[model samples]
Target chain A: EAGVAQSPRYKIIEKRQSVAFWCNPISGHATLYWYQQILGQGPKLLIQFQNNGVVDDSQLPKDRFSAERLKGVDSTLKIQPAKLEDSAVYLCASSLGGTTVRETQYFGPGTRLLVL
Target chain B: DQQVKQNSPSLSVQEGRISILNCDYTNSMFDYFLWYKKYPAEGPTFLISISSIKDKNEDGRFTVFLNKSAKHLSLHIVPSQPGDSAVYFCAASDITSNTGKLIFGQGTTLQVKP
Candidate 1:
């Protein structure tokens, strides 16, 4: 079985510029998630999508970050007016079901973004 | 408030020896715990998981021990190999949430020497 897929493994942008990351989850997966991993720290949950609807985005920066999963299979995360602090790896993950915590998540290669 | 923490930033062990990684959590609500291994440029891959009800779970050469009373967990890799060298992250989730949201630790980097 194929794992989660992401694009543009590495990205570089100037401060205040906009950048977008794409994610295509595993087949038949019902839940998708976006996370940010800064150097020396573990990945932090940015947003979570259950099918086409958002399940949680409380930790996301509403002023600069946004994400959407229109068809419930693919998702995109965008950051506008990126700041130097936003330089980190953005990881996408997906699980089989949304109702069970036992489902194991499969992660993608991740997009490493750097804002200079 | 950091709910999960890996105090050791790195660990080195000889091949064929044992490698142990530790993690601690402050949240009592976390009922499910998991361990993930990650290479330098790739994302984390699930290694092993143990529920709160169980104190230990083993998979092949990897074993995870959970101490609910102390809110601590450890991952053990026996007869460690060079391929086992990577960053290990400990994650937890509260089943009640039903969303499968995971809270992760800072991660521990393991280096196994040949």
Candidate 2:
């Protein structure tokens, strides 16, 4: 079975510029997530989508970051007016959406973004 | 507050030896724990996991041990190989949330020498 897929494995932008990352979840998977990982830290969840609906986005920077899962299959995460500190790897993951919360999430290759 | 932490930033071991990675959590609500291995320039892949109710769970050469009373967990890779070298992260989740949200640690870099 194919795993989660992401586009533009690497990206570079200037400060204050905008950048976007795309993610396509595994087939039949209904839950998607976006996370940010700094150079030495583990991935921090930015947002979560459960079938075209936002489940959690408390950590996302509302003033500069936004994400959407329109059809519940693929999702996009955008950051406007990027800052130098925003340079990090953005990871996308998915899991079967069901009442069981212990399901393992499959991850993509991730998009490494750098804001100069 | 940092709920999960991997105190050791890195560890080195000889091939055919044992590699042990440790993690600690401050949240008592976390009932499920997982370990993920990540290579450079790649995303993390699920390794082994242990629920709060169980103290140990083993998969092939990897084993996860959970100590709920101490809020600590560990990953053991026996007969470690060079292929096992990578950054290892431990994640925890409170299944009650129903959203499957995971809180990850800072991660430990493991180097296995041939």
Candidate 3:
């Protein structure tokens, strides 16, 4: 089975420029997530989508970041007027609908973003 | 505030020895905990997980132990091999939420030498 897929494995943008990342989840997976991992840190959830609707986006920077999952299959994350601090690895993950109490999340190769 | 923390940034162990990576969390609402291993430039891969109701979960050479009372959890690798060298992250999730979003700790880099 194919794993989660992400495009533009690496991206470099100047401060104040706009950038966008894309993700395609595994087939049949209903839950999708976007995470940001700064250097030396674990991935932090930026947004989550359940099927065609958003489940959570509490940690996302509303002023600068936005994401959308159309038809709940592929998703896009965008950052406008990037700041140096926005540099980080963006990861996409997907999991089948919850069966047990805990669900296993499979991740993609991740897109490394560097804002200069 | 950082809800999850891995106090140690790095650890080194000789091959064939055991490697223990620790993590702590401040939230009591977490119902599931997981461990993930990541290599440079790649995303984290799920290693093992333990539910809050259970104290231990084992899979092959990897084991996860949870101490809910202390809000501490650990990942233990038996007979650690050089291939196991990578950054290990601990994550927690609150099942009650619709998002089931995971909160992660700073990673611990493990170096296993032959």
TM-score of each: 0.98, 0.98, 0.96
> DockQ for each candidate?
0.88, 0.87, 0.75
Backbone clash numbers for all candidates listed:
0, 0, 0
Candidate 1 lDDT over residue span B1-114, tens digit each: 889999999999999999999999999999999999999999999999999999999999999999999999999999899999999999999857767789999999999999
Model 1 chain B poorest 10 in a row by lDDT:
B93-102
- Could you tell which candidate, 2 or 3, scores higher by TM-score? 2
C-alpha DockQ for predicted model 3: 0.75
Q: What's the CA error at residue A96 for candidate 1, in Å?
A: 0.8
Off by over 4 Å in 3: A99-101
Better of 2 and 3 by DockQ: 2
**Tens-digit lDDT string for candidate 2 (A82-101):** 99999999999999988787
When summed lDDT is taken over every stretch of 10 residues in candidate 1 chain A, the lowest stretch is A96-105
For model 2, the stretches where C-alpha displacement exceeds 4 angstroms are: none
**Candidate 1 local lDDT, A1-116, one digit each (tens):** 88899998999999999999999999999999999999999999999998999999999999999999999899999999899999999999999875566889999999999999
Question: Which ranking of candidates, highest lDDT first?
Answer: 1, 2, 3
**Per-residue CA lDDT of candidate 3, range A34-103, in tens?**
9999987789999988897888888899999999998879999999989999999999999886754367
- Cα shift from native, residue A11, model 3 (Å): 0.8
Candidate scoring better on lDDT of 2 and 3 = 2
